[model samples]
Target: MNVIEMKTPKFLVGIETRTQNSLEIKGEGKIPALWNQFFNFFKIDKKISSDIYAIYSNYESDENGQYDYFIGYEIANPDKYLNGDSYVVKQIEVGTYSVISPINKISENVAYSTWQKIWRMNAKQLGGERLFHTDFEVYTNDKKNGQQSLVNIYLSLKK
Candidate 1:
């Protein structure tokens, strides 16, 4: 895990949902449906980076509680897409992050496994205390035929 500082707020444009970790563990989560919405229903207005962001924010308490999940792209235009229908804009506030890059590559299944590995980790393994406010996974544009080869999981950390 590597700690990095984000000096500015980053904006993401796409679909969102409120879910709990328990729901996801049971495989009855809305996040899967949410991803389908992103690929099938999401409209990309402006292009910035091809990296796909799976952002977790607005925590009710922590990883054990309900929080907002968003899957989208970093957009160049936020004001134009603020109609508030199905599309929503979320701003990732500036903070410190512990970035953990999984040894495995992309795929929904692999992402799940990575989280499983993380959950099994101890406090010393985490490097620091977790904030769980705006943790996210970045699917970098390093693949062939519209596939990503790596996913970097960024966990928000307490100062």
Candidate 2:
């Protein structure tokens, strides 16, 4: 794990989808469907970045195991790409983040296991309070065929 500061001056423009479920339910099946739509849009639009991101924000949970989650990719330009319906823009605040690099490439299981390990770590050992406002996973575009890739998971930290 490493600590780094990132400046996100531009908007993250992409399609948005919501899921209401418990953490135990792992309703991440919607993610791949979103990605499929994104890629298809990318092929036709040719305006978005190939680098994908899965952003988890607006976290809310109740005693009955219900929560809300948003997932999308970073777009190159919002004004041109945003359709004002399914596609939307989110302005990310610049701040410090605790970055975790998974040992193996990011797959469904790897992402789940990595988050499990992160949740199990001691708070003091984590070096900062987890700011649940905006935690995200970055998937770069340089992945080689059949080769394992490293994923950087950025956890927002309280300033």
Candidate 3:
């Protein structure tokens, strides 16, 4: 695994779909549909960056022990995009983050392992306390032939 520190700028605007429970999480057969919907809705609008993000804003479990998850892409102009009731725009605050890239192919097993490592690492070992407000996963689309893609998980940290 590779860990590094990075200063990220605030995301001015983006479209998102929120899920309250782990069962309804984006990758659990929802992210593909959400991405399709988002692209179809914003077909004419150009994406500001190829950097897609999955933001975890809240981890406080509800009555059912579930957290909140938001999956979306950053946009250059919010005014140009049309909004609907299902698709809401969000503003992400700027912060310093601890970015971790596990040296494994993008798969459910890798994700599970990476997260396990992260959770096992405490604040003292991580060099700061987790903000837990807006941790995100940065998706990279560039993939070589016969190679698996990699995701960089960003954890919000406050010293």
Best by TM-score: 1
lDDT of 2 by residue, 42-158 (tens): 332543555556777675632133333344556556676556575667756689888887775666678767877887766565668777777777777444656455567888788
Error of 2 at 32 (Å): 4.8
Residue range 40-86, candidate 1, lDDT tens digits? 88777565988889999999997789999999899766887787787
Per-model C-alpha lDDT, please?
0.84, 0.64, 0.62
Model 1, total clashes: 0
Location of the lowest summed lDDT over 10 successive residues in candidate 2: 61-70
Q: Total clashes, candidate 3? A: 0
The stretch of ten residues in a row with the least summed lDDT in candidate 1 is: 140-149
Off by over 4 Å in 3: 1-8, 12-44, 61-66, 143-147
For all predicted structures, in order, the TM-scores are: 0.90, 0.75, 0.68
RMSD of each: 2.0, 3.5, 4.2
Clashing pairs in 2: none
lDDT per residue for candidate 3 within 1-159, as digits (tens), equals 334455445453344555553554435645456667656764434667666677777666431344445556777666654555545565566665777777856775565577668878877766677777677776666557364567888787775
Quick one: best lDDT, which candidate? 1
